[model samples]
Target: MSLREACESGKFVVTAEVAPGKGTDVEHLLKDAAIIKDRVDAINVTDLQSSVMRLGSMAFCHLLTDMGIDPVFQVTCRDRNCLALQSDLLSAWALGIRNVLALTGDHPKLGDHPTARPVFELDSVTLLDVIGKLNSGVDMVGNELKGAPDLFPGAVVNPGADNEAAMDLQIMKMEKKIEAGAKFFQTQGVYDLDAFEKFMKRIEGFKAKVFGGIILLKSVGMARFMNKNVAGVFVPEPLIQEIKDAEDKVQASMNIAVRLVKGMKDLCDGVHMMTLGWESKIPGILDEVGL
Candidate 1:
């Protein structure tokens, strides 16, 4: 089934992240995608993930679509103006890309180009609204369009916020995104299932499909870095220690991911596995979780 159909059908959906290369060398990227293409309902091509410059997501997503794989084109609002953003969306539709994930990406200072200026012409919430406009045969400024893109749009939410106020704000933003025409939501990386259960409780009665984000922890250092630097993501001490004490860190990471996926399967409509550089591990993780 298509990702949109899978979400609306209330099935236990699964998607994985595919990061583009720093250059035009897409041969490796396509090869990696082929590994998990059949294993996932759709693959999300990240837009310069981590604010680092790379191949554009739209180009890579088109490649994935040409390869007969459903591509969820992730559009971040950090690098493009409203015109460029809208133009990209229309182009994506013309190229047969149906799924999109809107995001207010990381600042450029946090990436390879520390001296580069970042553009925040529109945030994710506003971008979601723009998608609705395009779907309704209009532009952001209410201009009529000759054709409209029938997009199954989604927005990101952070269920793993560090504090109560932050969590509440995340829920409020979720409400805005849904009102702005978000068909589904993909959350930030979640480790605390009990906390996520509470988050679900607060968002009860909402209609959007929720997908819990799961990032595999490769080592104690990685876990610590995310905990300290990554907003809305906290690696519980026990999980960090699990990696620290493991004889085989890779296997330990896979086991932890499987545990998180199994725990979230019942509460969420889907789980988005983000393995970063370990894309090949996704198929194995899915097999272990029986997804």
Candidate 2:
């Protein structure tokens, strides 16, 4: 089933993501995705994650289509204005891409190119509205189109935010995204299930499907770093200590991933696995999660 169909049908959808390398080398990334083609409903191609420049998500998505794997094209508003955004959206449709994830990308100052300028003319909410207009056969400014793309657009959320005001703002944006035509949402990394369950209760009335994002905790140090640096994602101290205490860190990490996915199955519509470099572990993880 298409990702959209799976989400709308309430099927326990599974998705993974891949970030392209710095150079033109995509063979490893493609190989990684190939292993999970049948296992995941779709694979998300990141758009300049952390504001790092790499191969464009649109091109990588087209490559995925060539491999017969569905791709969730991630588009961010940090680099492009409205015109370029619409143009790229049309370009993506022409390349046989049907799914998109709109994001307000990280600032260039956060990446290798610290001096680069940012163009945040549109945030995630307005970008969703642009997608709605395009889907309705009209441009952002009421211009009509000879053809329109049937894009199933989604957005990002942070249900694990520990801060009250931050969580409230996330809910408000969630509502705006839905009104702007977001069909689904993929959350930030979730390590604490009780907090996530509370978040689900808070969004009980939302009409959009939510996919709980699970990132593999590769090491105790990685967990500590994220907790210290990442704003919304929190890796609980116990889970961090569990990894630190384990002799086989990789296995422990996968175990934690399995636990998180299995725990979230009933609480959310799906799980979006951000496996980082551990794509090889996905099949085994799914097997552990009972598929």
Stretch of 10 with least lDDT, candidate 2: 158-167
- Which portions of model 2 show Cα errors greater than 4 Å? none
* lDDT of candidate 1 at residue 112, scale 0 to 100: 94
User: What are the per-residue Cα lDDT tens digits for candidate 1 across 1-291?
Assistant: 789888877889998888998999989878888898888889999999888999999999999999988899999999899999999999999998999999989999989998887899999999999999999999999999998999999989998888889877888989999999998888889998998998888898887999999999988888999989999999899999988888999999999999999999889889998888798999899999898
Kindly list the per-residue Cα lDDT of model 2 for residues 240-285, writing each as its tens digit: 9899999999999999999999999989999999999899899999
Error of 2 at 34 (Å): 0.6
Q: Give lDDT per model, in order.
A: 0.91, 0.93
All candidates: TM-score: 0.97, 0.99
Clashing pairs in 2: none
Q: CA lDDT of 168 in candidate 1?
A: 79
- Candidate 1 RMSD computed on C-alpha atoms after optimal superposition onto the true structure: 1.1
The candidate that wins on TM-score is 2
